[model samples]
Target: MSNFAILITRRQFAITATATSRTVAQRVYVGKPDKISNIRPLAILKNKNDSPLETQLKELQMDTQQWHHKFWMNHNKMFSKSREEFDEKWFAKKQVSSSNQSETTKMLEPEDMAIFHRNFLHNNLEAQRTYDREWKTRNKKLLFLSAQVAFQRFYFKWFKSFFSRKS
Candidate 1:
């Protein structure tokens, strides 16, 4: 076939394939009821006030939410240190006051400068690693949160369209 004819054929084939794939992926819904008279319609109750049961359930739900909020807050505080707490201990310069000297520090200082140097280097390296880890973790959390929101929106749109077509 000529190039023009071949291109036309290929385009037609692609369009056909896409339509076939879509039809195949779509579910064939069956057994839809014509009327649901037994179950009360939500629209009928729209202008009505809340029932006592519903009011009690809503109050209980709110209480549960508050309890969960307080629980998580206390849990987080127990497990995690504030930035101010970390900075006060690690970043602040220590006083060279004689009254604050521990017996271990005094012994270590006199025995060898190499031991003190090694300890300082080890602590410095550990702090650096901790900071790097926290930085990466925060970035990862941000990326994950963004991806989750995008995925949920996509799923919501797809399901909405699919069900709307069915009905």
Candidate 2:
């Protein structure tokens, strides 16, 4: 084929592939009484401010890293549960509930569930990474605050020097 003909063929394939894929508008789906292939729609959070949960958490100083660690470590009893409950309830059970089901049956081979596991593991790792980064950031701020609170080396010197400099 000529170079132009090859270009045209490639363009045709690009157009076809793009056309076949779902777009954002299609995200608002008319789901069948059937299995889902993609993400479930999220409920809109109409009111962003003043959730009861946030208020309760704040009263417990949950924003502080130590408090958060203590709260989670204590409250997440499954953290030290038998391995089966830990795996079955927290990890594998998520896939079962998240999967779409019909009136009578659910899809067995809708997609290989390993992809879901792969995605979940990837997400879990990313979340842990972000959590570590935030903890480091918070620790830096706390360290700076402690230094400001306890260190007065420059304060007395600056105050005494300011008057002398004017003279």
Candidate 3:
């Protein structure tokens, strides 16, 4: 009975292996060559005789973007530094309190890191909430300002065209 089962298993394995090899062999690429011109690139801003107002607006946009990027970069750096300090302090405390100093001084396991993360988040929850609220308010104001600028530009263009046509 065992020999019969072994024979059946070997036959099934051989069948699956051959089937998979046949499917792989059938998956040859039979498509046309790709065209480089089909790919679309990002828009590049060009200063092609833009008006003074347009230039200033562009500069303002760039400056705000830079400020936003810098803020996030600095925030991330601060968060990382704080996390590292927390980890070090916690590890040191554990090492001092633990009777097995050598074991406690070893690298933190995933579970230990998780507990530290929870504690860190709990400690900074209020500060984090405040930062998030301020960020959201700033972003909302910036968006409104942008919309106002766009509407003003559109209205100015329409007014100029109307007067020009009358003249």
Per-residue error for 147 in candidate 1, Å, reads: 1.8
lDDT of each: 0.40, 0.39, 0.53
Error of 2 at 19 (Å): 70
Global CA lDDT computed for model 1: 0.40
Off by over 4 Å in 1: 1-126
Residue lDDT tens for model 2, 27-75 = 1111122122222222122223424443333333324534445434543
Highest lDDT: give the candidate number.
3
Q: Write the per-residue lDDT of candidate 1 for residues 8-45, one digit (tens) a residue.
A: 13432321111112212211112212232121111111
Q: lDDT of model 2 at residue 153?
A: 30
Candidate with maximal TM-score: 3
**Cand. 1 TM to true fold:** 0.25
Output the better candidate (2/3) by TM-score: 3
lDDT: the better of candidates 1 and 2? 1
Decoy 2 TM-score against native: 0.29
lDDT (0-100) at residue 103 of candidate 2?
Answer: 24
For model 3, residues 6-51, the per-residue Cα lDDT tens digits are 1113432321111122111111111222232222222115245444
Candidate 1 residue-wise lDDT at 103: 32
Q: What are the TM-scores, per candidate, against the unseen true structure?
A: 0.25, 0.29, 0.46
